[model samples]
Target: MRSLLLALVFALVAPALPAAAGQTLTIAKARALPLGSVVTVGGTVTTPSGAFESSFFDKGFGLQDGTAGIYVSAADDVHATPGRRASVTGTLKDSFGLLILVPTDVSLGRQGLPVFPRWTTTAGVSESTEGRLVLVAGRVTKAPASDLPYGYKFWINDGTGEVQIFVNTQTGIDVSRYHLGQALLVTGFSGQFDTSYEVLPRSPHDILG
Candidate 1:
């Protein structure tokens, strides 16, 4: 009778226990999970905390490992600067067209070298490059416009194709200095807004004549 009673107690207690965390995945594999699915990923922080800001996401940082990269959103500044390795557990979310991880927990590992930006042309920025840092050079094909209330945008074209460059107000990057036909080297995270893919410069330092 006591053994049966203990069995019943064990069954009742088990239901209240929290579920185990999902297996750790590479950033690329985590990005493949269905939206809203919980997952854990390990990578090196590619952006300093609060370096990139947007209305569509919380203040956060970018993370990348050998496989791929992703953005991690947190309510508060995580202070996970570039080159710091971290393990993030979160639910997958689609912020506009950009894939992001809304972290429930973040564990920092040892500091290491940050992932370098891949050099590509305007035509090369696409879904496969999303969330990774990239460098692209082109002439201004479209001038600045206030498409987003918090930011300004312009388009650049290499001989190959065109890509948008979005400067968020938070970055204090002055787009007014650029004009049609100006040649520039731009570097930033590859991002998507709705159907459009863009390269977002983190600061004036990311832009060069």
Candidate 2:
């Protein structure tokens, strides 16, 4: 809702580096992309999306291009706000089945526009919705709980199925204020831990009541 200007630097632009060989970089391409492929993708930062430097988790921010969203790990001091457009050139990585980008270079770009979340069900998220931003409309029927050293994990049942929502302490989210079984609309990047699928919210707005 605030004036969006949160796009970080574009890590794909380098005068010395050669252009993309054959990789067509885009969020949609990454969805079913082959492992180890090097490419460049650009998109807008969604709500709660920005640099999240933390010791426990990878430091970066969430990005979306209307088609989908994914996490981008940048160096410390790289700050981008929500709605900032960013482009990154890197290799695709599957960290225990969770996909991400290992960027090489970085540069800032024009601020991106705001992007609304894509409403999806728990089942939809569980099936094949990793590495993207989505909206889960459901109720926080229970108090938020911690998932050990990983992060603070919560539960929300959309009547379709139950799903885990993870938020790190450094993500700027205060889970203590949330009520149990309260109607909420959560926005976050879909991720996974081992075999279970989860959503990693960027900030408090990701778990709105």
Candidate 3:
């Protein structure tokens, strides 16, 4: 009788247990979950670890799968580079306006080619593009009046609409060469800052005029 009672107790309590670690969720599905929910996602690393000097991105990197992409924050603990496949478990967060994952555990997998940048128009860059690499070509519609402490901010339009291009100072990409009306081909990670959606080039090579 005691054995049966114990078995019944175990069965009743098992349903309340949290999910096992490492049960993977696609990047898009994880993004849709409520904040503070623990989730595990597997994807290819889109940005090199420690690439951005800002504390906001320090130790963090970007990851993307077939469904979507997302930035992993405060993940200096894991060694990741562009093209590396990784399985990360973390809690979802909204840093400023950008959605990010704060990792608690990370596991690296086989290396592969980095995900190709998707070609899209300036206006095509929306919430869906965030955390993914993209290629855009447009004329410089608005040039930076002055450089901000973080970097330069400019606008580009490809007739469909206009989008902001933010050249972070840490990347050492000089924006002075890009002037108003100049046609430019740019490749970068589609990201957001506060309320504005912007493209962030990883290096000077990401820009071609």
Candidate 2: worst 10 consecutive residues by lDDT?
Answer: 1-10
The positional error of residue 164 in candidate 2, measured at the CA in angstroms, is 0.8
| Better-scoring candidate (TM-score), 1 or 2 | 1
RMSD of each: 7.5, 12.4, 5.6
User: Compared to the true structure, candidate 3 yields what TM-score?
Assistant: 0.85
lDDT of 1 by residue, 1-209 (tens): 99999999999887543335667878888887789989899988877777666544467888887788888987788788778999999999888888999999999999988678989889999999988989999999999998566689999999989999988777778888999999999988888889999998877988998
Residue runs of model 1 more than 4 Å from their true location after superposition: 1-22
Candidate 3 residue-wise lDDT, 1-209, digit = tens:
99999999999888554456667888988888878989999999987775554535467788999999998886464668889999988899888788889988888999999888899999998897998888999999998655566678899999999999988777778888889999999988888888888887878888999
- lDDT of residue 189 for candidate 3: 81
For each candidate, the alpha-carbon lDDT, in order, equals: 0.85, 0.68, 0.84
Give one digit per residue, the lDDT tens place, for model 2 in 38-90.
77888876533342344225556677675666666655445767777777777
As a TM-score, model 2 comes out at 0.78
How far off is residue 192 in model 1, in Å?
A: 0.5
lDDT, residue 95, candidate 2: 64
Give per-model TM-scores. Answer: 0.85, 0.78, 0.85
| Clash statistics: count for each candidate | 0, 12, 0
